[model samples]
Target: MKKNLLVFFCLISVQIIVSQIRNVDGSLGRIPRRGSDSIPDNEISVKLSGKTKYTDYKIISHKNDTTIIDTTLTIQKEYKFNFLRKDNFELLEFHNQGQTFTNLGYDFTNISPFPDIGFRAKMFNYFHIEDVNYYQVPTPTTEIMYRTGMEQGQVLDALFTTNFSKRFNVALAYKGIRSLGKYRRSLASTGNFRVSFRYETPKGQYTIKGHAANQDFFHQENGGLTPTALEAFINDDPNFNSNRARMDVNLSNAESTLDAKRLYFEHTFKLLSSKDSVTQKDFSNLKLGHSFTRDSKFFRFNQGAPTTGVFGEVITSSGIDDKTAYIAYNNELFLDFNSKYVLGKFRVKTMLSNYRYGYENLQNSTVGITKNKLKGNAVSLGADWNGRIGNFHINASGMLTPGSGRLSGNSFKGEAFYKKDSVFTIKSNVEISNRFPNFNFLLHQSSYDAYNWENNFVQEGTRTLGGSIASKWGDASIALTNISNYTYFDENSKPVQFSGDVNYLKLKVSKEFSVGKFALDNTVMYQKVANGDSVFRVPEIVTRNTLYYTDEWFKGNPLLVQIGTTFKYFTKYKANAYDPLLAEFRLQNETEIGYPTVDVFFNARVRRTRIYFKADNISSFVLKKNYFSAPNYPYRDFVIRFGLVWNWFI
Candidate 1:
């Protein structure tokens, strides 16, 4: 125990010294001019200095120039390790990206202020920097857009678990699915099964697990139409697309673990089949290979002051047949301490890691964020302080990473809440931080997305900070926000000159109540963008109410009905002509748009049988939009949906 504590402090001290001795300066990024002229830095990529690591890299070029630079930055490093030796860490692991690399690129057009279910969650709005692409032609003014941003998908899943003894249990599961939804070329059709058995012992548990899945992506062209910016080009160009690279994988893992009152040890092994045959060329954006990894860890007590642990994981990738090029091994070491009293009011936990990124596909975007621009590797060290007083809780953390030629910046965020009464409450938060570009924008020089008809490219917008507040009294609630507020630089070395700052503010209020047996809820909101524009967009105001009544006379059954509609307003400019590099000063009046949608449902039960019928978008609203959602197409009109759900298993 004493030796463990001594090592913990030693590692912390060494980390502090290394952080101080680091040599670096703020990195300079690039922002292209709005119009046709290209203003690239001496180095193709100005944002990443020559000394950054553990991030994506890129060639910040323009429609007219494509130059290579000395360094690209690795701004963000996150390692999610499993606490147990047999645990392997991965989020939504082993996802099948379909038949192409479309899932490998930037997908920004989805945030067109349109009510999209899939695009909202990937949280695409977090990054918006420069634009890069090939212009087939321009676009023309349209009277209306139709059936915009449509997607389809289907999946099947099953599971089973059993325990033969007090110390042993076996579990198995299988999944099958197919989908042409979400991002471009972002489709999937896959099948996979896994089985694991664990045994508990006095000292620890012994376990073995294995699994494999295969996925194929569809390469469909002329599948849709796209919209453009130029009036001349809009009429002359056809929005056609092709698939680039194909991706597939076979994966399996094994691990052993030991757990005791004072010590813990674990070891893990993982293998992935990454080599894919390139029979077709959608574009020369991606190359496939094989990746193998091993991870291990240990945790011990140090005189009982606190728990201390050390961990490491390494990975290697190789080309199957052609050794023209491959990936090298990368590793990281983590040091941890807990329950350590710091500053009298806080308990501190610190960690540090060094690792390299695996390979990824790139994109071909001419006017938006992409993954091709992000690529690099580096060491990461962070500290988390926990503090509490009465009903108040506070925390603070920061990181300084060096990648390419620049020192990637850090961020600080915190939140608080209070309750004044049983029915009233108040909450607020002050968060300031920088968000790096998406994975595709910084790494992998190959195609990432393809199904949607977009080529892959790099994204280079970083540095974002903001805050928000909310309060509730009686049956009413109000909120104020400045979610995206900051001055940003592009991948170039120059500052972006906008008509104004990239700042926005919002105000909202809502009330919840019920009339007799019907419960009702309501809300409304308004926002003002920094560009002197007031737009009503996204997750808009709506009211929903459910009427309930007991029909005990009908075999102890109940009758319930739900009705709801959402109202929202916003506007997007569809210029007779537009420059992908610049935004023309030609503005349009606010469009008082109305999306009155409704949902109705019925539920009934009789003994062991229960039934449900639901209807959505009863108004049959078709999609409408002016942005280049796919390639040169816009969503138009309203649509409707109806379905029945049955519960057969509990």
Candidate 2:
């Protein structure tokens, strides 16, 4: 069966490549312009992943060119690929976007808003600045957006981009978020800033591109609600009422903070060039480039008193103070080729990196005062290929480290996608990777009982095969994954490595129906685990349904509004518990969590301003109050939130 699957994919890939070549003659090789003039004012080109070459792919807006205030806000369709929902800008949510404290699912990592840490948080997707999008704006462009949540939560974002000349451009972006949760000691705050520049010599022979960024994350840890408090709240105790602040928590005076800084620069000089008849400009055929990056991260956890009981006994003499720092420097040299014959691009690069990671526990006498450190150097080679034929696109990349350092490993990722002009699309992806355990999971020491671990673990290997199909009706996707030597925190909140292999299969489906101005959208996910349910736990079924009415109102249809109520539910299962000290979710068998949650929201747009009002947990009055997002962690209670986003151009 495996051999046949491989053969089938290979044959499909070959067919796609052949078809692309055969249709190349009739292809325009450029995205169609939407305006009457040669250059569309609403058209903007984008290049991601630090690619130096220009492509015809562009993001075009349909709004007319006018003052920023004249622009109208448009509702964004919710993503259907994931089962997560968006809660108010705060912590304690069941698999939600923007909110913290959720299951990792197939991510195979912890949930922390630190960019320097090996773990990835859902919020990181909102702060990632690696992808660069160049705009062809004739004038300066600036956008400012702000959103306010219930309690004291707020989010602000600002962006400015402009070109000094046809060959030089720069962009700056800033995002800030602060959320004071309804529960005590559950505040979360983050700030991210980035500045990037792209420059090209007048002759288009030499180019320089770079970006510098800083990110900071802060959150107060409230080690789950006490069992007594949870029971009282669930039974509708009058003393607690609906106020979460009165609920007793395990930890009342603890905070976690992370700070990170990054600088990346790449410069390329063309070795060969040819004139393009279509654009009347010189394009680089072969280029030599060098890239450099410096990244540093610091994490600190402070507690007013030593943590004890439940998790374990802490043998510490003083208050808890734990710190971890990581610094890495990377340099790479590469050669890039832009093929003129096959209409493809390829690049090969070699990189050298120096990484240093360490930690210090101030209150733990057993670990001493001296810091524990680990440092190493790694050398690796990587290559990437991207091409298009007809309406199909293919991208593939691979990297390997020849056992030169502790981080020695190999990874391969590839994807093929075909689109048939508003009809349907099909995409397939495969990935194989071998990666070392995260530094924190391998060696960590702290004054808290659940915060100390030391182990020499083997590298973890993973393979995933996925495919998706999308059309006007809906979309569906399936993924099959296998993991070997899986490392996770066990039921005891202790780091453990599973020696056996684990397999997972996931399926997602989304469908939409409309009647007049009313619409019903549903997303469902089903997951199956083989041989690892004890370690890897997930709800068997997760579903979200949204029913809403969208329409235009006011004179000249200037105001657009959408009122919707969302219902999310999951099957009962032994959900994993979270470790506040380690910022990781671990397997647990003592408690099972599964509940139905409902939220009502009203969103509107006026000109270039978008506004949102949401009432979460609206059905708490009727549903069982014993609901929990994770074991021992009571989900947020009923709450109302309001926010807005506004864009401006100058």
Candidate 3:
């Protein structure tokens, strides 16, 4: 009977798992200042002071040019000037001797034909129509800064200021790049637009964003495995490529402080083909959260909502497979001063939720079907406090959940913050989390076409510790960061072997300097990544640098240039090869693609509105990483975004 009921729900879950895409115009956040037009220098003039002529004014002819002019006028007063070109001596700058000008009082320097560069800059910061172009260095996270804006990678992918009407803030962008002897990239084209707006509907802060993009592309990979290896492989699929109609939309409300009704939804759909053996996955859920307190000091806090976590990948499962769906009701409650909260400045939060999980391989024949109908319940309670004084802040918390059957464990976290000066801040933390096994982890099955085998999901626990130091100097800055984590796998009840963990350390610094009318920025980052298991995706050592220059030397019309590069060195994988049970070794001279390697990269962005150009993988240094024992590949050559961007905001 239990197996029969589980089979029924698994059949119905397929309908909810269908793939869907949503609008993306508002995927990024609000447009910021540090706007492209900001001048690094502190001095500039911006004001309108030209001759005010009145025809047939109450005339007073001062004898010659020697008459001292001392004048003051009201709204209806008039003034006039009449002189011949030859006899008219150029007038010097007119000064507003009394009433101050706009913010940061305008400086009135006595000079001829007011300094052009200094003149426009004075008001540049106050003007409308600000945009950003984003371009950046490639890292594991794939996050690039907008260069033309305050950051990198922002130049070519420009977004504009708020639409004066307040309905939506929108902009247009184009991204492109080049590499090796060949240059290919997907352009933002004309439909690349992002918009965000807010309204007061008596509910909460209302926000909506829309993004539309239609990008064309090329083959994803060019090279192939050796002929002998290819022959031995059973299933060899072609590279994956497609022009997707990608759109993402987000809406939420958090307007009034007195209101606690918030709703958020985000969807990503692809207008693509299942030819690459695509398996559709639908991601959807809703939540309602609120906060309550007594005497303005939060004692008990709770929020309840319907949430979901899913894994949907596109693969040819014989019929229609590769989808895992989780639908659960989640609730969290916390207490700052509990029943004898234990410590002063204490706080606690606990979470309990029930979920129905389902996984199915589309082509279910015999070995294709596996199902588990289960429920997950977790409770987490934590507390924190600090001894505030000179420059020290310390706190800590612990949480635990003993699940049904074989699922149970406890976890904890501790954190601290120390500041010695205005320029420096130090942050540190330690975390340990235990995840109990469920139906999906223990009863799910999928065919591994890439490796010609079968794989199953399992339970695991993770522990992490790390922190960073942020320091600033002038407009330039620096940061030192470090993080390490370890993971343990579970078989039936107890732990078995160490799965994998990663550690990374980095030092990053950057500065902006101006040469003539051009602005330039230089930044460099050095990072080291280490993996305990043979699951190698992170790099041993990677260095990245970016240079940016802008041509706003003259007002309005400007030119921008950004260049970036990355260097990496990898260590051979090494395990206790001598120990038979725990054997692992770094690939050597005659190994596969996962062997130790070196790579370099170069990317650039240059633009001026509707017209722009760029290059990615300028050097074509194929920096790649190996992910698993079957010798999986993590490769990056270059991806470029370029073309025309047409947008106007009113």
Q: Backbone clashes per model, in order?
A: 104, 1, 46
The most accurate candidate by lDDT is 2
| Segments of candidate 1 deviating more than 4 angstroms | 1-375, 402-407, 419-425, 442-500, 508-510, 531-553, 558-594, 603-612, 621-650
Give all TM-scores, in the order shown.
Answer: 0.42, 0.83, 0.42
Candidate 2 TM-score, true structure as reference: 0.83
Candidate 1, residues 534-646, lDDT tens digits: the string is 22122223233333332333332232233333332223222111111111111223222233334444434332122333343343333322222222222221333222211
**Best TM-score among the predictions, by candidate number:** 2
Instruction: Say which prediction, candidate 2 or candidate 3, comes out ahead on TM-score.
Output: 2
Cα deviation at 371, candidate 2, in Å, is: 8.0
lDDT of 2 at 243: 70
Candidates' RMSD to native: 26.3, 12.0, 25.1
Could you tell me which 10 consecutive residues in candidate 3 have the lowest summed lDDT?
251-260
Sorting all predicted structures by lDDT, with the top scorer first, yields 2, 3, 1
What lDDT does candidate 1 reach at residue 334?
A: 25
**On residues 545-609, what C-alpha lDDT tens digit does candidate 3 reach at each position?**
33333333345434333332222222332311110000111222233322222222222222212
lDDT of 3 at 77: 12
